[model samples]
Target: MTPHEALDDLTRRGLLRSLKPLPDNRGRLVVAGETWLNFCSNDYLDLGHDPALVAASVRAVEDLGCSAAGSRLVSGHLDLHAEFEAKAAAFLGFEAALLFGSGFLANLGAVPALAGEKATIFCDRLNHASLIDGIRMSGMKWHRYRHNDPAHLDELLTKHPAEAGETRLVITDSIFSMDGDAAPLAAVAEAARRHGALLLVDESHAIGVMGPSSKGLCAAFGLKPDAITCGMGKAFGGYGGFVATSATLAALIVNRARSFIYSTGLPPACVGAGIAALDRFAETRGALGDEAMALAKRMHGLLAEAGFEMPPFASPILPVMVGDNHLAQEFAARLAARRILCSAIRPPTVPPGTARLRLTVTRAHTGADLIAARDAFAAVARELGLLP
Candidate 1:
């Protein structure tokens, strides 16, 4: 289709995407020159604008310059990269960690690298797009079990046994981003163990916001996945991605993963901020995540009592399932008009009819902010005839 036709098509289908310049700080976003209470950010700990992180980034830019200069093996391997990786590995309870430009690239690289020739992959139906892309790029057939349904996964595993000269791999995202629900990692891990298959968990939305100590959901379940992929952009309040695994696996990715071998190294500024976030995460003792979850629960209760339906939420990421895309859009527009801005998520980010407003509450959101959200939601629900 021509560019004009594509634009028209998107507009016609309500699938058109638009950009809004919303500068964020302390759970508030400035959109269209008006400040709005932000419930759409992934900065769960409110550290994106943290002073320490800003200072660290500023210092790194002044001292190390911007780019890594080249790929790590080609003179970009600075002392700071090594230092950051070491710290990241230790912090995440892994033997080693290799940073990528983003979480998408990490999965896009790791999935295929782990897929041995003629491999049989078992993936979750609701895994992130990156994971699906990685599996597809591997050029191997994969079985997708029902979303977070371990019984279905076990059945699939039993039916699709590894044949001669084939390897078995199980991949999943620990936290389902759109639905704000967690995977049954304990059960999946057990299944993988029973089948003698390697497991890879993308903790993109889980790290720094889960686990007993906030290491990740894998740690909380006492499961040691063959590899854990994480993005530093969400709860970390920084930007970058990394895979934490054994030294051997790390070495293999360095040499084999095409995306990693080809892409330039991540910016030093992100590294500095990431290190600072990790340190702060250690200092807080997971209290930031705890507070965010507590507030989410409070909001869920408030909204439910007010007659607005909520998704089955296990984290700060909450979804108001509107079912219809236009209704989701309308709900968000109403909320935005009231100076409370949350995003309306639609296909293909979610299922065709599961359009929703993915409201993410952070620790920085005060009780008053939550009260505004609750009240605004009630008003919108009633106006939209969603309330009885």
Candidate 2:
């Protein structure tokens, strides 16, 4: 189709997406000259505006002068980056950790490195786009199991035909990005072991939010996967990504991952801020996580009582599924009109009929904020005819 026709189609079908600028964003979101109770940001720790983290970043800039200068293999490598990686590897219980510019780049680099051309990848159906893109780039054979279904993954691993020398990799997100559900990591590890495959997990949303002391899904299960990737941008309250693995495997990624090899390193300021953020999280691990979980439980209960249906929520992401796309947008609009901000996750992000308001709660939100949120949801549900 022509560009005009394609644009027209998207506009007519309510699929046209646009960026909404959120400036001076803290717990109260600033969007289009209005402040909103933001339930859309991934700043799970509310540290985006934390004074300590900001100070750390500024200190790094004063010392290191902003840029990393070149790719990590080149002159870009700095002592600050090395320090963070060492702390991260030790913190996550891994032999070594390699940093990347972003979580997207981490997956985009690591997936292809672990599953080269001759390997077969067993992927979770709901794995994020970056994982899928990396798998595609590898040119490796791939099979997607039903989301969070270990039995299906096991079946695929057992039945999928491959050559004798082909390696097998099982990849999934520890905490799904859109659905706010966690993959069955223990069961996945078991399946991978039985199938003689290496397990790769993306802990992007779980690293600093889930598990005791922010150790992630593997720690929660006490099962060490072959490789894991975590992002500093989410609950870490910083910017960057990391893949933790054996020292040998870490070496392999540095040598083979194209994205990492080609891109300049994340700024020194980001690394310093990341270390500070992690330190801050470790200071009060369970308290922050438990508080957020409690608030989310109340949110789920309130919405369910209001007639919204969903599976048991195990993460802070509370998706209020509204199956129709237009209705989902309307629900978001109504919430925004009430000074609440909940992003409408529509098709392409989710399945065609599974549009939702992807409401996320952070520790930064107060009890009053949550109560207001619950009331807003109830009002919107009633107006949308979503309530009984």
Candidate 3:
């Protein structure tokens, strides 16, 4: 199809996406000269605008300039990068960690590096698109197990048993982004062990919010997977990604992960900010995370009391299901009209017929903010015949 035709098709299907440039402000957004309570942000810890993180970033730019200059193998491997990696590894309970340009890049690089053509991967059906793309790039056979179902994963592994000397890998997300639910990590770990498969858990959503000391779900469960990967964009309130693993595996990824080898190192500003965020987490002992979770639970209660269907409270993410694509967009539009800024999540970000408003609660939000949001949601829902 032609570009215009594809655009037309997407518009008809309510799948077209566009970017809206808005000034950065934690927990609230200004659009068309009006302020709205923002529930679409991933900055769970609300540290993106923290003064300390900003100061650290500015210092790094002053010292090292903006860019990393080149790939790490060439010249871009800065001391700041090394420092952050060391700090992240220790914080996440790993022997070593390798940095990536972004979380998507981390998965694209790490997944293929760890699993090759001779490997077979068993993946959760509802994992993020990054993981799906990474598996495809690996050129390995893979099976999709039922979401969060360890029994299904084990059955798939047994059916696709690894050949002698062939690798087997099981991958999952610790906290699902849209559904706001957590995987049963211990059960999944047992399944991986039973099948002699290496486990890789993506903690992008859970890091700095869902585990003891903000270390992540794996740390909370005391299950050490082969590797734990995460993006700093969420709770770290910065940009970049990393994989924490054994020292030997880190070395292997450096040599084999094409995305890491070919891409430029993370910029100095992000590295500095990440380091500062880690220090903040260490100092506070995850008190901010506790606060955010509590706020999310409270928000969940408010919405539930208003008669909106909600997934069980897991992380700060709470999905208000709308089902139909156009209705979801209308719901978001109505919320925006009420000075609430929640995004309508639609396919292929979510499965078809599962469109929703992916509401998120952050440390920056207050009880009053949540109450206002709840009232807005209830009003919109009643108008749309979604609530009594």
Candidate 4:
């Protein structure tokens, strides 16, 4: 098919995506000259615009300029990079950590480096695209277990027993991004242990929000996987990704992960901002995440009472299910009209027929903001006959 035909097809299927440059003002956003209550951001702690983070970033730029200037192996490894990696390693209970340019690059490099063609991978069916791409890149034998179902994972492991001396690896996300649900970490960990498989948990959505001291869900469950990876963009409110692992594995990734070897090092500003965010987390002991979670629970209650189906409150993410693609778009549009900014989520980001409005609550939002959002959602539901 021609490019025009593909674009037309996407439009007809309600799957075409376009970007809108919405200027952020604190937690609110300006769209078409109107300020809207923004519920689409993943900044769970609302630190993206924090004064301390801004100041630290400015200071780093002043000291090191804008870019890292080379790959980590080729002079891009600044002292700030080493400092943040050490801090992150200790904070996340790992012996060492390696930084990547972004979360996507981290996964794209780490997954294959850790588990190559000689390995067998068992992945959660609903894992993020980055994980999926990494697994594909590894060229390894793989299986898709049922989402968050430890029993299914166990069965898959048993069914596809690893070859002699072949590595077995199991990967999952601690908290699913689109569905706003959590993996049963303890059970999954136990299964991986029983099968002697190395486990890698992506804690991107759970870091700084779901564990004691904000270490992550793995820490909250007291389950230590072989490695835990996270992107700084979410709770960290910066740009970068890292894997917290043993010193041995960190060395292996440094040698084997091509994405890490080829990509430029993370910029100085992001490194500084990340360090400042970690310091803030240390000072507050994850109080900001607690606040965001509380607000999410309150909003969930309001929507449940108003007769909208919702998943149990797990993290700051709340998926308002609207199965049809067109209906999901309409729901988001109605919310935007009411000055509440929530984005419509559709396949192939999610499975087909599972389109939704992926609403999130952050520390920047208040109880009043959630209440107003609830009221707007109710009104929109009534208009669309979504309420029973």
C-alpha lDDT of all candidate models, in order: 0.87, 0.87, 0.92, 0.91
Which should have the higher lDDT, number 1 or number 4?
4
Off by over 4 Å in 3: none
Local error of candidate 2 at 182, Å?
Answer: 1.4
lDDT score of model 2? 0.87
TM-scores of all predicted structures: 0.96, 0.96, 0.98, 0.98
Judging by lDDT against the true structure, name the best candidate. Answer: 3
TM-score of 4: 0.98
Two-way lDDT contest, 2 vs 4, winner = 4
The parts of candidate 4 lying over 4 Å away from their true place are: none
Clashing pairs in 1: none
Counted clashes in each candidate structure: 0, 0, 0, 0
lDDT of 1 at 355: 87
RMSD in angstroms, candidate 4? 1.0
Q: Per-residue CA lDDT of candidate 1, range 13-34, in tens?
A: 6678899765655587666687
TM accuracy, model 1:
0.96
lDDT tens digits, residues 205-324, model 3?
A: 988896788888998899899998899999999999999999988998999899899999999999999999999888899898899999999999999999987777788999999999
